[model samples]
Target: MAQKERVGVVVSNKMDKTAVVAVENRSPHPKYGKIVVKTKKYKAHDPENQCQEGDRVRIRETRPLSKTKRWELAEIISTKAI
Candidate 1:
């Protein structure tokens, strides 16, 4: 089976080598049929601590590196503009 991958923006990188990423999911409500945007936060392992807030990054599912970090940073899609 293919591993899960997600692209989202880094919301926080306060931890030593962990980053909080916010991924948005858009889907229509089952009954109302109205589109809804739901945001979820995932803790991804950033071994290099290269991610900064607002940076666009790709994360891949992996073995748990920590209690909350089950995803690892794949690559930085785009860096936050200074």
Candidate 2:
């Protein structure tokens, strides 16, 4: 039983207590070492409605609260800082 963590971009924070985040991962090719980009979208529980779209955030696996929610916002790693 290990916890999973990820860094992603906030896609939407319009929900009352939730936010849609998109995680992007870049991997190097095994042969040519070319970087490949991929993105994944996840629904995370915000509980505070403080996240905003385009903001980078870290999330962790958590107890499911609904059919589509199994992640929670852990922290804001980097932001525009305004």
Listed per candidate, the RMSD to the true structure in angstroms reads 0.7, 1.6
Q: Over the stretch 28-78, how does candidate 1's per-residue lDDT look in tens digits?
A: 999999999999999999989999999999999999887888999999999
Q: What is the lDDT of residue 56 in candidate 2?
A: 92
The model with the greatest TM-score is: 1
Assess candidate 2 and give its TM-score to the true structure: 0.86
Of candidate 1, the 10-residue stretch with the lowest lDDT total is 63-72
Q: What is the lDDT of residue 79 in candidate 1?
A: 96
Predict model 1's lDDT versus the native.
0.96
Q: Rate the local accuracy (lDDT) of all candidates.
A: 0.96, 0.91
Query: How does residue 81 of candidate 2 score in lDDT?
Result: 61
Query: Which residue pairs overlap in candidate 1's backbone?
Result: none
Off by over 4 Å in 1: none
C-alpha lDDT of candidate 2 relative to the true structure: 0.91
Per-residue accuracy of model 2 over 1-82 as CA lDDT, tens digit each: 9999999999888888999999988999899999999899999999988898888999999998789999999998887567
